[model samples]
Target: MPTEDHQAFVNELVQEHGQRLRSFLARRLHGAGADLPDLVQEVYLRLLRIPDVQTIRSPRAYLFTVAIHVLHQHRLNLASSPEAVDIAEALPMLQARSGDNPAEQVEAWDRLEGFYEVLGELPPKTYAVFVLHRQYGYSREEIASQLGLSYAMVKKHLAQALVHCRRRLDAME
Candidate 1:
């Protein structure tokens, strides 16, 4: 395709299906709407790279197919990042152990209340990252994706949450 033609074709596709494409990606990503814009851009970039858009019989289907591929690649990239595992391992400090006796259970309950108080004091995003990862078993990368934060930011939030909880809980003892 000529340069002008290719641009026009790509622009037309974006104009027609951009909103639906974004909605599709947002749903597939499981509320990771933060990455929607980037993912949509990637899909269009891929579409532009196709040597012959004319060869496609079904443009809407083709567009969604490209979106699915982008989503798959995104998941693969997130899965291959190894740093999330290391940070996740360091989070064992946040896990509460089971109490074997009534006195210990009472102490555990007290500590749990203190922990909730500390969580409430956190900035909303930090608290979300901490709870989603620790309580809900989401990986750091997943939290980063869902929350639209960088991986380092997610790690920092988790660390801050941990430190704050520890200090506050210790004081409660």
Candidate 2:
């Protein structure tokens, strides 16, 4: 099919069924479906990448088929993921043992809040890069390979995470 025709076809498919497809993913993904927009975008990107949209006799079938593949991959990624450490819980242990006072407690809580705020601001993929690189000690190349991303993308994510963390921590000071 011509590029314009193929684009129009994909656009029409999305316009017609995007909501249904998103709900399908949300049902399957549960909590992880918070990134439903990104997942939906990935489905669209995959559909657009097809060399010949004509080959897909049924666009609905093709759309759902791609969505299922995306969801399956999502499950696989989660299954392979390492458990993240709960730093908020662990922060108290690192504090000065003698200072069981209110002021010290507040300081620790503020620190934990700052940490979580920074982490919460990141996209799930960017947060994954931070944890994989900082907590799990994976090299950039390894992270890229495992996540099926480019090395440069890994670096960009890591940098954004670091910058955000630094700014948040600085504000906490």
Candidate 3:
């Protein structure tokens, strides 16, 4: 059950916006284009699923929308698996943007304080797990070995850490 023009339309999308979509994903994905091709294929698969491709007013936005969802799934996978998530990658995201002014500095400090306050509320081992990975740049395997904990335990701790961080950040906002 193949539409005769479906392949043609998919090709058009790639021909027109392929580079732009890849570039957008590259920037969002830590500037690594390793997964760029796979993500693009996924985008095409999604686009082809639409019953009518002609109905799309802005294919560029549609492509971006799918790409972002794909990126989100990638992040969620990272959140669950320490081997994929990098603390350095998370740091910039966590940092509060500050203007070049004393007032902005004060606000940033306040946000930092709130973040630390939330971290402090976590269970001791869970907090330690986060610090080991983020501050020490320890792999989850290394953290597990250092703490004499199981891999599953390390993953659980990371999940707990992420949930707590998101909850507090949302509340603060």
Give model 1's clash tally.
Answer: 0
| Rank list by TM-score | 1, 2, 3
**Per-residue lDDT of model 3, residues 12-38, tens digit only:** 878998888888667666644687788
lDDT per residue as tens, model 1, 1-173: 34776778779988998888888777666556788889999998888888887787657657866776676566545434653322121111233454456566556544644554555566556666776788569988898987778999999999998898888878877
Backbone clashes under 3 angstroms, per model: 0, 0, 0
TM-scores, in order shown?
0.47, 0.46, 0.46
> For residues 1-173, could you state the per-residue lDDT of candidate 2 as single tens digits?
33897789888997999888888778666578577888898888888789888776557756876776665456445645665311101011123332546676556544543564456566656767776777567899988887778999989988998898788778777
**CA lDDT, every prediction?**
0.68, 0.67, 0.68
Q: What is the TM-score (0 to 1) of candidate 2?
A: 0.46
Q: Which prediction has more favorable TM-score, 1 or 3?
A: 1
Q: Between which residue pairs do clashes occur in model 3? A: none
lDDT of 1 at 57: 60
| Worst 10 contiguous positions by lDDT, candidate 3 | 84-93
